[model samples]
Target: MSLVPDILLTGAGAFILVSLVIVFRVVRGPTMQDRVIAVNAIGTNIVVVLALVAAATGNRAALDIAIVYALLNFLMSIAISKFTVERGGVL
Candidate 1:
């Protein structure tokens, strides 16, 4: 077995573990902000996983998708902030 595959597998495993923890927080969080944070974390982890998978499979389209995901994440954050402000900081 090569070290590259081993490293990739380890990285993927770690990303999954962290994603599960974020999932737990998203499910059991007491506050909306906590859940939002978890969701954002999940998105970030998804991007990371996709990038790794793209690298492993030698597919460049995955990189494009990852970039789009990052942009979406940024847009979501901005929209959330705008919504919260419009809602008088209650959201």
Candidate 2:
């Protein structure tokens, strides 16, 4: 109906597509660091998607959940890096 909704939906779709491509990179990465980076990129895309959904649906709760998810993603990345370092660069 409205152009704004169509635009947001398109953006969400694009984000999903990008995330899928990143997933492929994660699965086929030659190195652990590359996989970790791909995973992080996926997480970022997920956050953007969540925000888009929240805006499209006018749901404040979704925004809050997205914030929490983002924090968790950041912590996970840090933990992965620490683990890799402790394991002598082998993940």
Candidate 3:
């Protein structure tokens, strides 16, 4: 029963809670850009959670997945922005 694991779990839980709030914003966003930003934030939170889990479990694979996920999230944000611009602000 180490305190380190408990702290890591708490951190992950906090990240998840914040991500959930971001999800609500994404769902209820008044504009497309707002939703996009919220989605990006959620992705970031998820990445942090993955990193924490990797640290807690000493699993390198989780960190690798987090890296790949972060790349995909970045690409998706760019694509969404481009699409928004091309479509004249329609999501």
Candidate 4:
């Protein structure tokens, strides 16, 4: 049997903590822009977590999935921002 390295696990744990804290901002942001940025931050955090997991497990496929999710996250943020701007940019 094998164990994942401690540092990778620790880094992933830290990012998870940060994502959890950002969830509050997503839930109660005063404006649409704030919420969008928070959501984007969460998305980025998850990708980092996924990459860390992949490294710890020696599975490259998960890293590819993380990259794909990151691209989607970027596109989604742009789309939502555009939609909000078109509607006068407020929640």
Which ten-residue region of model 2 has the weakest summed lDDT? Answer: 1-10
Candidate 4, residue 48: Cα displacement in angstroms equals 0.5
In model 4, pairs of residues that clash are none
Candidates, ranked, lDDT:
3, 4, 2, 1
lDDT of 4 by residue, 2-90 (tens): 55556887999999999999999999999989999999999999999999989998899999999999999999999999999899976
Off-target runs (Cα >4 Å) in candidate 1 are none
| TM-score of each predicted structure versus truth | 0.82, 0.92, 0.94, 0.90
Candidate that would win on lDDT = 3
**How many pairs in model 1 have backbone atoms within 3 A of each other, for residues 3 or more apart or on separate chains, i.e. clashes?**
0
Please write out the lDDT profile of model 3 over residues 1-91, one tens digit for every residue: 6789779979999999989878888889999999999999999999999999999988999999999999999999999999999999964
For each candidate, the alpha-carbon lDDT, in order, equals 0.82, 0.91, 0.94, 0.93
Error of 4 at 20 (Å): 0.5
In candidate 2, which residue ranges exceed 4 Å CA deviation? Answer: none
Error of 3 at 78 (Å): 0.2
Quote the lDDT for 4 in model 1.
80
True-vs-predicted CA distance for residue 1, candidate 3, Å: 4.4
Per-residue C-alpha lDDT of model 2 across residues 1-91, encoded as one tens digit per residue: 5678678878999999999988988999998899999999999999999899898888999899999999999999999999999989974
Better of 2 and 4 by TM-score: 2
Which has the better lDDT: candidate 2, or candidate 3?
3
- Give the winner by TM-score: 2 or 3: 3
